[model samples]
Target: MPEQKAADATPRRLPPGGGHRGGGWMNAGMPAERSMNFGPSARRLLGRLRPQRLHLVAVITLAVVSVALSVIGPKILGHATDIIFTGVIGRQLPAGSTAEQAVEGARAAGNDNFADMLARMDVVPGTGIDVAALARVLLLALALFLVASLLLWWQGWLLTGVVQRTVRRLRADVEDKINRLPLPYFDRQPRGELLSRVTNDIDNISQTLQQTLSQLLTSLLTVLGVVVMMFVISPLLAWVALVAVPLSVVVTQQIAKRSQRQFIAQWTHTGELNAQIEEAFTGHELVKVFGRQREVEAAFHAKNEELFRASYGAQFISGIIMPAMMFIGNLSYVVIAVVGGLRVASGTMSLGDVQAFIQYSRQFTQPLTQVAAMANLLQSGVASAERVFAVLDADEQTPDPAEPARVTRPRGRVAFEHVSFRYAPDTPLIEDLSLVAEPGHTVAIVGPTGAGKTTLVNLIMRFYELDAGRITLDGVDVTTLRRDDLRGRVGMVLQDTWLFNGTIRENIAYGRPDATEEEIMAATRATFVDRFVRSLPDGYDTVIDAEGSNVSAGEKQLITIARAFLAEPSLLILDEATSSVDTRTEVLLQRAMAALRSDRTSFVIAHRLSTIRDADLILMMEQGRIVEQGSHRDLLAARGAYHRLYQAQFSQPVADDATLEPASVAT
Candidate 1:
């Protein structure tokens, strides 16, 4: 019925230990941690990059070219070292001595092992260091490195654009999806939880892509290139260096497996904590009025503690990956160093070849280490992605008709034919009830809480689809008509007044954006908003805060009424529209509404029976059925359900000839 009034009239308290489920107060639609599907979620996240495939390909190409250049530099430096070593050995021998003479001289001098080492070297006894060749090789290596660095920079630039564009598209999709979702979807989801998905989770996804995409690509390619180069120099050393690969894999898999659950839990707790904070702040005054500040603080602390535990566990477990990988890499390095040194001493492998192989071994392990380090970010990103994807994948409201019916001249003749609806399968809120509001009639629905008053108006607006019968507006089924078209013809003023962060003038003109200043002022005067506006320093330009806390509740209600008046719609729905206003202001509002409702059908759902006494038709509802329907006078004369309600409400007997006027009721 009057949803806001019903909710505010009765508040439900959480039972003791109620919110500790799954380690936090889980939202209705939130998936359980154990149910998270990492693989499918990750794949779907990757699919968002499909639109940026061309840019990704270019990034991959740049990475490959740059890494190839980087991998070849070490071998070139080794060759330069060989040239210097040869020249240094030549300088130690006698001038003009031949290579054979040097070896024999070394053997004759009781250095036979040295002679053997010299035999393997391309040393000239008479020559000095080849400075020219060394310079050329070093310069070549420098040039290659410089080019590789430039390519990497360009790749990073391209990758950044790709990531930002992808995130932008994702944000647009989420916005569109929210607009398409049914009202019940929001009823199930907490505002803060949804905000977390839209803002925080999306931001996390962006950061993860920026950090991991380029680095992961370069690391993978570097590993491959380095492995090939290592084999080219010495297959034996290559095999020895690869001994760490399997071990690194094991460590990463084990840590990631454990850390992934923690990451999911961390984000889940984050959302829950956000919801609690939003609720506490929004209702801070109420909490104080009820002396529940301590309880609120206690709930906040519990949620915050859950978040801390989840975050600490995730970080602690994932942090072990890098150190473990480094240890494995170091072990491989030691083995490669000893084997390469032994090969060099035996003269089977040149010193330069061993040097190049050692460099290659380090290069191979470095990328492996980088990959291990990124495991934490990858896991966290996937967890956030799953949350976002869940929203994207939720069931949307039924689509509007393909060929919508139009009311060229709407007379606001709304009729419900055997309409039935239920929020749940077992609990019927409205059933097989029918009613009609003729053109230019003011229909007032009066009832206690949960009497289907607001629900009837909601049905005419097509907020919820009927389970059986259909509602028609001007002989056209509301479902067949486009929602925008139907709503455009109707103006609504809810008990809960909503004003955006804007000027008073702007808020009043929200429904009629193209209305002139003269028209806006007229509306404000009609609804008594102009009376207060003239007293404010800024007058019509006075700004309202996001929560409209800057204005009094009565003034806020007046502004909303003025907004509805400005629309000049074919039909009007006022659900406790004057509930917030004082008696004087409400009397003024009644006059304004009388003027606005002229020649237009109006539906007014009110608990204050005095406001609707003059309504042409009054429907008294109870338990989803209309117990009585007639003019206020006729219903009182019958002394039935409506008479009993009136007597109970006023708590007094009234003379049959006396009229119950607004002014008298206010007194």
Candidate 2:
């Protein structure tokens, strides 16, 4: 269903109070406090690339050559300029005289090699113009340019595959980590924020690998190569250019340091914004019903504004690198020009040599400016990588015991022996709780909100480890069994129905992927889902949208019931499974549940007293302990909490075997 249409179609009968206001979206995946170690995080990130060491070496080699060509091209062009200058100056000599005569006349006392002496002569045909030599030099420069371009392309092509493979492995590791995480981890995190880590943060790392890595390498290489070339041309001009290097470094470091916090803040705020949007849209029904549209909008606007401020601050601070470096570079250039002009006038350095030194000086400063500009980008990429690594570094759930036991065909006898648990260390919710349910018995757990009804079920399923004692299933300690084996034998139909985007048949058969079509049809028919399935045009093939929004809440609940039924587990848990259905559907559902629970051990957590009045054992809980426990008649005779609860829910004592049905009660 389109989001707009679904938002507009509010349920005709919303529960008296809105259902859970804080849902999957309310939790931001990231922590509020920001802390990171840039050096360690960068090292760890680079370590992931170790598998691509060969590819990295090749890329670095190519980058060095590319930068070397760029540095050499300018010096060669300067040589051409020198040749033209000498040709013009030599015009004062005889028409065919070359600069070789002047070099020979000014020969030093040291012996010169034959090749060196030959190179001193201009090989061009004319004395005033070396057209052929200039053309040859230009042609060499063009060839270098073309070769560098090809090397750059080849480097990029190789690195792209390597980077993609690395990211792919990282993404897979993250996915595996998520699966191994304890339920409490998810409880403490926001769904959207976690999603941001998996997507936004990882994507940022990919982009940095694709673009920034090559550029950064090339820039650093260019800077080093240019510095060396500058010194060769004229150490005086080289020193002048080096003066700007430290200044640029100081400027870049200062600005980047200031921008780091903003970059972290920007990403953090982005996570908050994504979480808010996810929550608002997921619970749009509650917002519309309670007229909380303005409140949601205001909350979103606040987060968006915070993100905007952080993003702007990060950009503005990092942006200072380029212009500041350029200004310093330009100042150094002017200094070199003044010094080199005096040397040329005094004939200590020829005009051609001075011109070549100027070219080398420009090349020296260009890469410094580029490096400054890239500092911010590299910092941001590191921040993103740090977040991705955090997920990989998270503590995982305890592994199953060595030589774990497997339940072949569970008899469903469960015993909670002196079990103690609490969500937090300071707040004890369940203490020394003991309970037993034999095979084929119905154990009804009824309690007020926060009275540990769901906690009891969670313990039985081993979704959490007990603080002090053991929970046993069929006389086997649950802790000794693999979690997958333990949960596989226990089926649950929760209050909140969850159905992914798929055909109705797929949703119903989720619990047993290899279930035959006949079994699926039979389970759906038993749960009364077949009645509604036939009404739809596509029947079992109809697609259910995300959250099963295309279907009504009651329909969604029934489908989940069918899923549990199809699994045919030895133990069944219905945690307000009938809460969403209408009174009529609930009655039929109860009948179906009765048949489904006939031979299996069942735990029913509900607020409606009528539904559980006939349970084999009823546990009326207050806080974390069971205050009352007995058969319905025995409990009423005691006139205790269960009796009081039953009296409050009905007009009179319910003695009828079949006529004591009541609607869903808010817990």
Candidate 3:
């Protein structure tokens, strides 16, 4: 089997956001990574509310009261129906009965009054209006309705504050989790997919809590409240309404279960599409240079089409719930009406009772329809919650030692003693590797592609833990010291330059936030960054965009060099740091690096043989092992693997006179 470098050294296969589809967005398609469990995720999400339990209790209480007020209004209206019927029948009022007393007596008679009906009944000789009783009941109903609306509003207002706080904490947790995660996590996962979990997923949870959460509580109470009222009116009719419950459950469960998988697919495809878009846009210029625009568009179209299919399936399937529920509810309604009419006619129930029963039945089925309708959204919220929790629960980097050794001033002496590591457990990339670099020495690493040159640098920096190895700095084990302290003493400038949106001064001072203005200028001048910054309109204050697109790639590299200079590290690692600059700038950067490396140990990994020809030591690696180690002159004299590589990089091919094919360089 072919050898592979350490995991971090391997090229990332997925774009920044191109997450794996299995186990939804949370798992990111890694078989070793764990997907979130819904039950645990939900419990953790609700646990966030523990701090605001009192507020949540108040919100629930208010929701229940609001529904209760709305539920009882119909019953009160039924009483008024009886009053109007009695008044229209010309019932006479007793002598000396005041309007208020007559109204009370009318209510006591168990049949309520309507003000308009009572006024019209005055024309009959044996009848008189009972306006006071009708007005009292109507006013009470109106008051209850108004008060219930107020309660609903208040509950929503309180919930808004609570949900906002919950979302704030969630966002904070994700931000912190990003820092705790291992570098390997980001290598396999896209920044965009992780961002989707942090921003989009958390936002989804917030929306559900703000809007759907309150409605969920109200719908549940309405269903319960309506059920009790149904039984109270007539158990026979109640049984008929209850028939819709199981049927609704069966239909909703079947549809929701199918759509749930589709919902997961929809989000997974969404993450994939986002990752693709992010990669395409990030390297749009590369796409144009390589003439792969059509290919990119085709890939995007395929992912988009998949997204469309998943979205349509989830939505179309879930959409069936509302209408199916409505049909079931209507069927229950007809049965109740027919059966109830027979019972009323047979003196088993009153007209008012039947009227109340019909209203309660409508109330019962309405919430069922609502819950069924929101089934998709609820599942989406749960899925989002699961993804968010996955990040929170992901394994963090190895913790620092309990009693870490303090490095007061790291001396640059470094050593690797029988170090062995692999990208995967079974694939050995490095075995029994050993090397030593004394203080203030320049140790250059030279190797072909896939020779684990960068992997050696990663191991030295401890970006990845070794499978079996002991690396030491100044005779002290590097792992025994706190990572922050160990890393603070080392500085690196890589081929890929990273600069955030900020002023030139801010970007340079990023590693040393408290550096003084004079100190910054000194470092900038040392790295020749001051030469360019002086030409810019804002000098060092020029604001760069997120990608630093305003500056050329070489300029970005110069700025990163200046950043490392300001860091004043004891050990420096340059991984083809001058690959982007022109020959003139490269010469200047070499002089600056020589000056920087005078007192500090430096490790240079370069393909350009001329760059490392003057180094104190040179190590030639092949297939994850150091095949040759010596000074440039000694390697040149030995004529081994390093000699062949140096000759390939520097030697030109002879022209062939006989054949049409170009002559090949001698090995």
Candidate 4:
């Protein structure tokens, strides 16, 4: 009953030779090649944000204001210095004061006692300090500091909305894409890589986008404004600060290239690690059965180490970015301080001008630091963008003709002509196989494994395009008909019946939601699922967890059949319909199948000959070609491939028929 503990606690038994090796992987040393193909997906990635432009506007405004506040805060401090300090110049306060004495004298003139005294005293224009003016300037500086604080908070608040909404929408788009994509896309992609794009990449982008976009834009504005202000104060000092720009750009470009390459590898290795973990846990039964615990752990360790190396390498290169910008920024400040000091000492510049130059130099460097950090985020985001778009670029399974003339319902008569397919150019999996299932009849296909049996169904379902063939329903070419229309008509009961984690009623209702509860009960009763399900405390309302692990394989199979019965399609394709069930249950399923197929056309691929013993036609196939065709009794009498296979499957003298008679076996 507890398959997890029962399976894990025991030793693992792998299938011989090709299962798990000493390290739990048959090909443990498979070369690690995690290459990404990056191209013009940047524009496309930006378009993914179309729905959230309003949030972008709000975020950008905050960014601009926040940068202005921070950049001007120091500049205001510099201005305050000029207003408060009176230097020794040719212009002096009417000779009642020294340069230091003039500043002290002005401070006393600012207030009630001071202003009245200053107004009463004799002070000349351009040579005197006004204490009242200095106080007013200091008040303005205080207001600038307060504004800067508010801007930072505003930036944070605006960014929160952008990050949460954009990330939610982006995740939703990926999820929607997953549902829209044809099944074949999943066949080629590792689940781990796809998962990494959704979880890790999107999460990184959300955290970085609102903040980094703000930082980068604000930094650019600050740098430009400061550079202009620097020239206003002194062109020579501004030039010294500008010297690092070209070098920083070139170095950052190099870092972007290296980090991009490493990030691609990092995500790939992360995917491989996840894939290994999923495979290890899912097939843990196999691992433990063969006593492969040590080997499994060791394989996992190897994958983890590879991921660590790749991630460490990527972050290490990206990490250099901050220090590089800071190095240039610090040097720029020293140059400004030295040059401005020299100019002021030589009397070529006023003390106020020198102070302004230092302020502008800082303004130039701070934004540059912010921009450099933003560049790092940009590189990683771009890498993820490329990966996500790669998925979008892969050709979807083209739906059959769009806007085609409608056929309200399909009368299932399927024909395959000269059908051939090869997944790769050289490895032919299906050959020129011709087949037909007439309306209102069941055609059974039985052959050895890899005889193109499932491939036939896949082609019928249009999971993959055929290399050369024409498959038709009734008189219409299937490719010319809409895919959904065709799928809607055909009912499939896969070899592995998957029941999602929902109520038994919900699972059955998937095929037709409009079907009433009474219809669902009727379908279940028709398939005999009602027998076992009713035995439980809850009948149709009982929940099935993770493919109905609580129910036996036979019960799950019957529930799936009930779903098919509810769809009530004109055709049913059953692949290994009875393999997982016991002999008695198979008899029960066969009884249900008789009523299901009485009026509909059915194509069956079966290994259990008993279920298909009375089919109107049976096709015997080998190596992608059907070698025999006839009714079951007629084929058994012919002594050909069908005869041999039928005998081979049931050679044990029926294992005593009375015990296996299965009361009320229909047909």
Q: Which stretches of candidate 3 lie above 4 Å from their native place?
A: 1-44, 91-129, 343-348, 655-667
Compute the lDDT of residue 3 as modeled in candidate 3.
16
Per-residue alpha-carbon lDDT of model 2 for 194-235, expressed as tens digits?
Answer: 787899999988887777777777877878898888888788
Best by lDDT: 1
Residue-level lDDT tens digits of model 1 in 1-667: 2334333222223222222222223332234355367788888898999999999999999999999999999999999888988898888888888899899998899987678778889898878889999999999999999999999999999999999999999999999999888865665566677788899999999999999988889999999999898888888888888888998998899999999999988888787777777777877898899998887788787777778888999999999999999999889988988998887776677788888887888888888888888888888999999888878999998899999889877899999899888756667778888889998999999866767787778778777678989998999989998889999999999988889999999999998899999999888888888998999999999999999999999899999999999999999999889999899878878988998898899999887889999899999877677778999999999987677667656866556624543322332
Candidate 3 vs. true structure, TM-score: 0.87
Ranked by lDDT from best down, the candidates are 1, 3, 2, 4
**TM-score leaderboard ranking:** 1, 2, 3, 4
Indicate the TM-score of model 1. 0.93
TM-scores, all models, native as reference:
0.93, 0.88, 0.87, 0.83
Question: Which 10 consecutive positions of candidate 4 have the poorest summed lDDT?
Answer: 1-10
lDDT of 3 at 529: 93
Model 1 stretches astray by more than 4 angstroms:
1-32, 104-116, 652-667
- Higher-TM-score candidate among 1 and 4? 1
Q: Rate the local accuracy (lDDT) of all candidates.
A: 0.83, 0.79, 0.79, 0.70
Q: In model 4, what are the clashing residue pairs, if there are any? A: 11-288, 11-289, 12-287, 12-288, 12-289, 12-290, 12-291, 13-289, 13-290
